[model samples]
Target: MTQQETHAQEAERRGSFSSRRVFILAAIGSAVGLGNIWRFPYVAYDNGGGAFMIPYLIALLTAGIPFLFLDYALGHRFRGSAPLSFARLRRGTEGLGWWQVGICFMIAIYYAAVIAWALRYTLFSVTEAWGDDAAGFFTGEFLQVSDPGVTAEIVPGVLVPLLIVWAAVVVVMVAGVQKGIGAVSVVFIPLLVITFGALVVRSLFLPGAADGLDALFTPDWGALAEPGVWGAAFGQIFFSLSIGFGIMITYSSYVHRDTDMTGSGLVVGFANSGFELLAGIGVFAALGFMAQAEGVAVDEVAQSGVGLAFIGFPAIISEAPWGAFIGVCFFASLVIAGLTSLVSVIEVVISAVRDKFELGRAQAAALVSIPAAVLSVLLFSSTSGLHVLDILDHFINQFGILLVAVVSMVVLAWVLKVLPLLQNHLNRNGSFRLGALWRILVSVVAPLALTYVLLDGLWNDVRTRYEDYPGWMLGVFGWGAAGLVIVFGFVAARLPWRKDTPMDVTDDEEVQA
Candidate 1:
């Protein structure tokens, strides 16, 4: 068959985004998530306050967007899911793609539970359900968290909402790309912005809002000299942007071949950062109000992750005027953001499975999401779920995602020597031209910065147990889970591709592009 015929066949087989606009919205939806809302504010505060923006922007420019462009180039040029793209890139590297799929698998399992929690919290905001003790309510009542050991006992509160989240995700995935993922993005992204923007506005009028802003934005110039601050900047950018994973690669593969990927990357990258800044403003303003109401310092109430969202925010909601509105907006934003990101994460697995096995979209969605939902509900609805989730998140992100990212970059740039080829593809149609600097950033600087962050995290984890959890708990959920992903990757790669799946870029295909 001619290369044009092959492209047409593949386009029919694998759905494309309806247009570049939908692709941008979908990409932005994936990039902006729970981290922007809860994590970035604290990372900024802890790193160097406002002064951290220097390194943050530097990391975004030099590392984050560059890596994002690399993912875009790979997916757009190859026009396949991660595994299929890597297989076409070079057969030996297919395992790297599966490695990413494995990471997403583990991530999706735990990530859904968090979204479930947020979903419940969104409803709870109406009545101020936590009453006076948000922390106790979250742990003792809601999660009913037990000791740090595995158990089959389930928490009804978490299980029901978790099922809801999984159900919604399956429907979206089965609906295929444009109608499901794209439609949700077009709707939810705007809703999220409106609700969260109102929440930020509400927060600014609260008493002591200025104090929170001051605490967050006050520059610690001396922090610029600290290597740890730079590391923190790069680490936050990496985690926040959703790069170095199969997500962007998979999403980009759905865009038309001639789409301006570089331009889209810039929009997504900047939009995510803009939202993070808005999050900082909103989160800290509420936190500052909490501190004033409790007659304490802003630092006393400041927290991140679950604590910030479920615990600290509840306390703020209980005190602030129009507090229920604030609570609903905040938690709803979490649900919206988390749901969008979770859909993208699950899609990586679905896309890879469909490509490798040549399954229909509905079949792939059901196969990938059902088992994931069952495992997610089973693991996270139990008393020990929190502990396991905590350990898995920490270890998997540090070892699984970051480690594989470094390895993928090395293989693609050094071993396979495909940087030039990808660059050519990007420059041919990209609005922003990529040249040698882009290559150096992807191959050298980004990896080196990531390596430092990875090694630093490794040394810390090795020196002492994460969160001082029992050794066995860390051993199983932490180290053992991370190791299993690598093993799963190589094993999955060994499985034969579907007979009809194209595994190579023919010479004719090269000329056609």
Candidate 2:
């Protein structure tokens, strides 16, 4: 049988999302994570405050959602994970899919550790256990963080929770799509919104909340002229929406054939942005209150990434009314958001492995999770683990994810000349018709934007040691980690695709075979 014929049969064996709503919720859950809550607010504030929204929204419509639609069409049309789907597109491109999946593998391991930290802090919020020195506690006392280059013993505080996180994720994967991933996302996404909504409402009433809102939305119009601002906006949209990780492709593969592809992409995009905007409001309001209490500038208290979540927010919680309660809700929301996204991240690898090997879901889950869990525990559970996580996360996201995205767009828009084909599929299966504009966005706008970001990032890295870490450390954890992703991608792609018990195609209308 031809490759298409085999893929057609495999579609029947691969499980599906139970409904359109479930699929959308899962997609939203994947998109709305720590980036929305911890990263977006800071990024918006720095890039021109309220003024940044213009560029951000522009990127979302032109680049973010367009790429989203492309992934949806590819996955729905091909009915496989990134490897199988890309292989279907063209024989040699299968390695790119594995490369994308490799990036996902890197993300999933470190991401679980971050989620584990949130879990620990949720319990710590009970008494503001970090006391007055939030930073000291996080690094010196709690983590016992070693010197950057030194490897320290595991910290139980991080390790115990990380194990739970891995187990929970494994359970969800093993539960199968509808009962496991779909069901959890349905519950978690709503709960995440409600919890954060209540936090936002309470925050809006706090003294100095307006100051935080001002910092978030008060636009410095002149900043718009800077190239960096535009770059930031585009970067934020790309990273925030969970594109480029084989996630949307993997998720959309399970979507029902009759589902509205265009509508689904729009819904996921808008939902992600909506949550991000809401998160900005809540985060800034709390920071404003913190700034007021400290008699400092909002920028002094504002931060992003692990610093913002663990240090700055803990300080804010320590002073607020019912501080303990608010702290619990805040960290709990982070855990929920992180877990949902983690599920999608791991699923990318799981789906790829299952498709490539023709293994059962449970078997694929075990193969992926066991190594990922071990790496999470061994590397991140150590006192130096946070340092390693920071370095790897930076390099992987900058060099790995962004580069893969640029290449994927190039192959689709230029190499294959398939934008028209993908556009037709979207219009036929979706309520909304994608026209010349969509094609232009994918072919012209997105690639240029992504390419600029990639170049800027490379320049920045070459100029300085990230965070002032030693050059050797950066080489080991930063560039070295990224290089390994490409190496593994080709290695995994070279493995034999399963031939036994080819998947039976229940519906071949959308599939090429």
Candidate 3:
């Protein structure tokens, strides 16, 4: 092969040895964080009580796994940043690729808004907020204080220490892939898992914990008929798995040809979803027991508020034996889990900047941090940050993940020239082949499924506009659109588009469809 061919091949080999491991753990850590803690138990409280699990699992198998495999195949197949994967996979038609990348990038920025919340909660933990005196503590000192407190007021003796714990994540990324992300994931992912496992063991031992577990596992088949239930299941699957976000594709770009992407994708997906299930077990069992003792069913705590985490969980912990200790475990797990996700989000911004602007590693790192920190402080300073985060999350999940899944399935399954890189690599290694059934899934069924998700999202928007949710929703929708456009503009600007740009076209490759 010529030198050019060799260099192209060499570029195809991205990521350090630890990159794949870091990618899997980091992705799983992002998926398993706030969803398992805040979202699942509350939604489950109302949606089916114990009955939602059936649909959630069905949605997972049908939608989540298929899309997970599809992204793994496409991201590693192209060996480029997400937008590049979509554009490069098929050469000339890069619009959809830009769209996917744009959506992912936007979500990444807004997700920092959520990480800001975790930072706030972590600060609260260090004070006496989770102690048996939590109610008095939160009501008097924590909640009542409006302006940002000193490290001492915010978290007492440990306030500065907690923020540093959160900020050290930025340091990890500053060190780059081989050293920073890999080192953290190796330690933190294991710590997260162990912490979750500890929570589960203690949760099961709680009185009436079995009742909540039964609620999570048992199914009311009648609830399956509710369109909203399916929507919740699908939404949860999309958000909780972190699917359709370009992070998977972006991370996959770092994979070496020798890496087992299918295996790795499964490991990450199952690890994430499994943690989610365990998290449900922990949270619901506690919620159920606590609710029973309080004489209200789980639905009593379903409101989305600052109290959701700060007041709600701490209240439960305060009522329990050695409650302060349990509260410590929960927040500890949250801090590590939050940082793992935080690093990935920051990396998304940094990766896009570096890829598009030809930035050095450190410059790209600082660029992501400065803006993220400023925006986070601005947003959280308002009472509305919590509500805004929820709204942005819904919009991002609905439009971003669903639509990317749609485009990705089409490009990889139909537009791409050959079997996706993972299949090719497996065959190259004489390791494993997906065979005809899996082939059909990658090429056709998966894409079709995403198309349904995509169309449903469009229809949801149209339907909602006619139905007219609150006026505040209009701002959310408007910002969501503007966000996608802004991110895509960044990506599109970076593409080598000459005025006479036929450069968009890559070499001719066969499209299977």
Candidate 4:
């Protein structure tokens, strides 16, 4: 092939989002996921209600948006996915990219199953099938509740829905970036916003809704003194913005060369936080009504994570007027939220493999997803699946995700010394210029905070076997899972790159660009 023709082909291989708006939507889609809807509200309430916002906003500025912009600069300037982007930055740094992608892969395995639960519940919402005993129905009738640590048979009830979730994810991924991830984000992001917006509005009209809002916004100023509350705020901002995973870096890799990285980062970050605020309104409003019906305080019925969604919310829906319709909207919104994020998680792994092996989009999706699907079923298809999911999720986030972020920050800012160049790229292309303050926030403040959290987590794990689970269980699943990803990362980094891959594309191309 002619040299110019070869250059065009290479550009085609590195896909671009159809437009800036589509890229923004896809980025926002990845950011606004299950965490914003299912986890944030409860975390806020538990961490001193309105007072949490103080540290949350501080973390957003110092850590969240700064890290987000740094990731964007790496992808857009380099024009490569995580593995290629990091490798382009420095030769030996490729392992960190693989590590982040591996973490995303592990997360995608269980995330699909969680979305499957939301999908099943959406249908059940029509019939109010959960009935009065929502907890019993969830644990016994729905999941069949096998004992923890038991090697139970697969529950068809869970497997069938999970299959549907993975199928949806595969279809979108097969369609490729702009036509698939971008198009779906355009549809799903707006739909999610509308559905949740309507739910929030409707919730405001419910009895005792005022009490829920009060609990959400009413500050316990004294609780702000607790160091744990500050840590909680930072943790919420860190996880909710989706910065630690390879998702942002991969999504940004598809953007046009001139795309505004700083503006985009601010928009995605604020949109994520805003969605969580809206969710808090809806969740607590529903919980307030539940508390009133049960003749107790909102705290009595209020919960977080799976318990809040499957148990508390379902019971609230069963008692509300037009219960079935409300339930359908709530769970449908949940499904959309989860699916949007799930695709991004799957894409991180697929993109990494595709870049390294030079595979076609469909081939890459199938290669990565087949194994992910099997792993999903193995871990989450049984009655004891929730226990398994909880352990993997805890260990992965605590050690896997957080550790990757800590190392990435130090590597980028200190070792590679690329922050200044990235800042220049963001300022030159973006409407708002990043100054010295942005550099300080990323190079110093963010790393220090992340290091503190990592140390604190290590200390806690040493002192107590997380949740008082047996040491063997933590050893096999918790630390073992973390170790597996680290091993895979190094192995993948050592794999041979595609032969046709340009030295410029794979090496120090971004530095020249």
Candidate 5:
């Protein structure tokens, strides 16, 4: 066979997104996860209230979108998963890709548990089943909280829903890129927006909603002067947009070569932010009603994370008119959002394995998903799962995602000296042209801001153990877990690639029409 024929065959072997629109939908699905609903409102309220938007928008433009463009350039130009893409960039950088895959693995194990909780709560929302003691029911009845240590004993409630989540994920993944990931994204993202939007509208009409808005939006202009607030803004954008975790790199790899990536990045960045803004409105509105019903200040009732979703929202559902409907919309949104994001996280590992082993889609999906499903069920379905998850989530985001992001950006921009090449690649078919400004952000501004956030979190964790968990518990799950991903990264990098794997882009294959 001619050389061109071989290249064509290889390209076909690696699937592409059916079109640019599907790619955008899938990217948005990955970006808009549980964080938008639960985390963003509190981050904004704590940072500077209404004034926080200044730093948040600045961070988005200066760091978030620029880093996104970088991911797209690498994936699209290299036409490979994280490992293959980095290997193609420069042979030594493959470890960075595997490091990202390891982070995704750590994330998937615990992330599914949260989705499972949301799934159960979606049904529980119907009857206000917690019966006024929302927190008690979540910790005692539902999870049956045990002491903070690993145990083999499982919570039947958690186990069942978690099993369902993993089963759904396995099926989607085995279906391949467009048929599975792309199709799910197209359907679920719109449903999430519509359902969540209806919830938001209902929230705004609640009696204390204006009070909640007042509390959330009342900007302390002075917060703008604080270094920590700005740091928080950058941190939120980094985590919210899913930039550092190899998700965008893997997703962008599936798009057609001629796609307008920069323009798409803008759409995604803005869309994710728009959803977060809507979330802030909906969440605080509900909190306002909760506070009023309890005869307390909004701050007294405000919460985030698992507390906000499982404990706090359940209480709201118990009291409000049309309470059952609100609960359904809210928890269903969480399930949909979490599912989309979880699928993307699992796909990163699947794609890396596929590229490295030259496995077919079914083989790679099964190889990655089966073990992941088993591990997820084992670790997160137990009485101690919540404690373990809490530590892993905290440590992984701070040390795993943020640290790698900084290192990769510095290495790509300064060590490998490929920002210019990547910029050229992006601009080739991009609607928006990148220049020195983009380079400055990727190389200088982003790394410095992220480094500050990383060190700040590290120091705080060291000074005070996260949540005052037992020292051994923190040691095992927090620091120990964070350290293991880095170890896995370099170790996996040393493993053999399939002999026939195309590790570098050939000259004729550099730019596809």
Candidate 6:
């Protein structure tokens, strides 16, 4: 069969999205997850209070949108393996494909840990397992990273449920994306949206919600005066967009060739970020009401704890009617959010493997999922073990992802130089070019910005050796980043560079034979 014929047959053989709506639903489900409700609110409040959104918007427009298109162009144009697309998009200016794959593999492992953590908390919340002084229960329990000096009392009620939570993640992941990821997302995404929206409306009616809104939106643009502010904005936007991780390439691979790239990226970006804004508003408003009631400041309570979902949110809900019900729904929403992203990470590797090796997606998925599950179980043994996952995340993100992105852009723009043609195909019967501004941004400006991010993140991480986090933790984390970079460079140096025929078609279309 011809390459196009093969893709058409595969599209028919595989369970294609029932419709465009389903495809869109799946996309939104993949993008809008725990990053929105759980992480964003906490990061927003802690970083700049209300002032953070200034650089955030700038980064969102410049850094986030342009890269969103970049990832989309590669994925839909080439469609199959993220690594293949990465290599193909650049046509081997360098072999940077391995770097992209490595980033996905590393994140696949650590992200499993995070999903397990969410699962642990979801069960705890459902059972009302936290005892009196829920805040103290969490603050005094397993969160050593939050309160290093305090002793973590082992509460069986909490610990046992956390284990069960880990099991749920394993089950969902092992089942594969088509059966597990797609099925769960179709149900959970809508339910999560309804539950979160309901809670946000309820939170607004609380005594001090107006104050909360002020705290999130009334940005002090003077935050722009600080270099760190811009850096934080850039970092968060990149992190939130999930562009560099190869997951975007994986998901978009399944997209239709003639799909509207500009519209699709915009919808996913806005929906994902918009919900985060809602989450921030609700969280801050609830905290504002809590502060008014307790006469304590909002900043005093915004610690990064898995326990916060179980403790803090319940406390906020406790004031309203159906407080327990609301708390349950909110935590459940987080559980849903966690699954979406978690499943996407798994799908990335499975999709890559299946396309490359002519393996079944189910078999490839098991190969990835089983190892990740075993790794998470073995890794999170010590109470301080969770911090290890953070180190791996940082090293992989900075070394693996940044390197691959730089190589890909250079290859496409300077080496193979067919990005313009592929992009033109994307724009046929369409509007909007990637334009010169984005060209400069990705080629010259973006790489420099990413380099600064790597150096700054690594330096700040290493500097922590002087702090109270124990010398060994700093040592492992510091050298880990450097080691990853060196290994990545070594491997990338060896890949062949040549002018190959551009296989620029969507997975639903055709990128290659």
TM-score of each: 0.98, 0.96, 0.80, 0.97, 0.98, 0.83
Cα lDDT tens digits for candidate 1, 396-502: 99999899999999988889888888888888778999999999999999999999999999999999878999999888899999999899999999999988776
Instruction: Give the residue spans of candidate 6 off by over 4 A.
Output: 9-18, 46-51, 90-95, 133-136, 139-180, 304-311, 314-321, 397-403, 429-433, 466-468, 474-478, 481-513
Better of 4 and 6 by TM-score: 4
| Candidate with better lDDT, 2 vs 5 | 5
Cα RMSD to native, each candidate? 1.5, 2.2, 5.3, 1.9, 1.8, 4.7
Q: Candidates' lDDT values, in order? A: 0.92, 0.89, 0.60, 0.85, 0.92, 0.63
Candidate with the larger TM-score of 2 and 6: 2
Give me candidate 4's TM-score against the actual structure: 0.97
lDDT-wise, the better of 2 and 4 is 2
lDDT computed for candidate 3: 0.60
Per-residue CA lDDT of model 3 for 424-482, tens digit only, reads 54444333345555666656655565566557776776667523434554455444564
- What TM-score does prediction 6 earn? 0.83
Native-to-model Cα distance after best TM-score fit, residue 296 in candidate 2, in Å: 1.4
Off by over 4 Å in 2: 1-9, 150-152, 500-513
User: Local error of candidate 6 at 99, Å?
Assistant: 2.4
lDDT of 6 by residue, 28-128 (tens): 77777666776677777655766887677777777776777777777667655576676555444223545565566666666655555555555565555
Candidate 4 or 3, higher TM-score: 4
Task: Write candidate 4's Cα lDDT for 1-513 as tens digits.
Answer: 864566457668867799889988888888888889888999889988998888888988889999899889877766677888888777698898899888999999998988999999999888889877999999988988776674658889899999988898899999999888999999999999888888888778788888888988899899889877777777778888778678888988888777788888898999999998899999999888888888999888888989988888789888887777678888989899888888988989998888889689999999999899999998899876887788889899889988889888888888878788888888877987898998899889988887777778889988887887767778877899988888888889999888876535422234732
Ranking by TM-score: 1, 5, 4, 2, 6, 3
Candidate 2 per-residue C-alpha lDDT over 14-101 given as tens digits, one digit per residue, 9 for 90 to 100 = 8889999999999999999999999999999999998999999999999999999999988887778888878877767888899989
Better of 3 and 6 by lDDT: 6
Instruction: Estimate the lDDT of model 5.
Output: 0.92
